[model samples]
Target: MMQLENLQPYAIVEDGPFLRIIFDHSYISLLVDEKSYQFIPAESSEIFINKELNKVHNLFDVFTFEKGEEILHVTVIDLMHMKQFRTQLQQIIHTFYEKRTMIPVAEVETIVQELEKENILRLIDRAIDEGEEHSFLELTNRLSEYGGKVEE
Candidate 1:
């Protein structure tokens, strides 16, 4: 029962080949070299220094993406991490709701102005609907940095 207001924003960390998204004691770490990921969910509201602590009963794996040559792997995540990451993704999507807060007014107008724009907007919308939280935030952050008004 954690709210975005209650949880701290996730921070991305560089650990050699791994990119660790950390929030207090919990983390979702991505391995750049292997195109793999390892996540360690938080123990509780109480802080712990051990990154591998698992309070949940079973360790689970969720397959995210696979292409002919491209691959991504996510390994070792507890249920709590999944739940919290889901919430965080929801919050990010809410910010980019169809009401159009984060996307610039000019950008919106431009999209509407073109008759055949290939509808990147629709693709983005679909991504919001079907995409995982980590990927969603990563894309949103990049868009924000490029031009969109994604929350900081």
Candidate 2:
């Protein structure tokens, strides 16, 4: 199957109440409305173009034309759809950054547990130096709970 890529728009002209999208061989005339849209294929008598337009569910949709084995795809998008897409893209980027900067609760809890273990070790050392039996036993118990061993 033959396919064409990067088909640039030739021109967009306002013809009466309709907007015309001009390509190299064919053109599409659109009568846009707030509630619905009317797409009319002009400058070409290919029935496939009309069939493709009939398949369009939205105002901004892709139309495909097939002549024998060679197929051409055309994208039709209005300015309003472009702006809406831009806004949606911006929102996606913003949400991505926001989630990236946020620290997970599990990670924060792990960090706090590590710091608590370090503090317990320091207190145990202080207890050993001062010869405090009660404090040394309590700190060693806490260290054992944290999966750390205190040498007797």
Candidate 3:
């Protein structure tokens, strides 16, 4: 079994026709199959399950590793956002790898931060469009702290 001690944050890579996640060099990669991915909200402990044999199953339950249990729990919206973010990041990683050029570790961090800002702005815009006053106020306040400009 692979040790998880040196596991780094996930980064997407294209493995032939599938996109997979590499969690540092020491761990086994996780394949990204959006069709089987699931998102569970923290507020509700319950997840949807169709009764088959008194078992509760979720979308994520379709995948399994020999020695790994649940490694993450996130909201459904966040999961969707993550999928989008991974696709963007994969392009950057692939470019650097293909060119045989070294990209500074710090650059990766900056990219992540910028992507986060974009996601935040998107959420704020969505809230505004949906007429969610509380969500807009909260999201905009958070965005401003990140030096993001909010247009009234």
User: Among these predicted structures, which one has the highest lDDT?
Assistant: 2
For all candidates in order, the CA lDDT equals 0.41, 0.50, 0.48
lDDT of 2 by residue, 1-152 (tens): 22222233344343343334344443322222222222223323221112223221234455544444544444543322454433433443345447657999999999999999999999999999999999999999989999988766
Model 3: lDDT to the true structure: 0.48
Q: Residue 90 CA error for candidate 1 (Å)?
A: 4.7
**Candidate 1: C-alpha lDDT:** 0.41
User: Residue-pair clashes per candidate, as listed?
Assistant: 0, 0, 0
Candidate 2 overall lDDT versus native: 0.50
Please give, for residues 21-111, the per-residue lDDT of candidate 3 as tens digits: 3333223233344222222222333223222332223324222222244444443233324554445434544554566567788999889
Q: Kindly report which residue stretches of model 3 are placed more than 4 angstroms away from their true locations once superposed.
A: 1-101
Ranking by TM-score: 2, 3, 1
Candidate 1, residues 75-141, lDDT tens digits: the string is 3353245665456534533443434436788998877655323343344566778866676666566
Candidate 2 has its poorest 10 consecutive residues by lDDT at: 47-56
Off by over 4 Å in 2: 1-97
- For candidate 1, the 10 contiguous residues with the lowest summed lDDT are 42-51
Steric clash count of candidate 1: 0
Pick the TM-score winner: 2
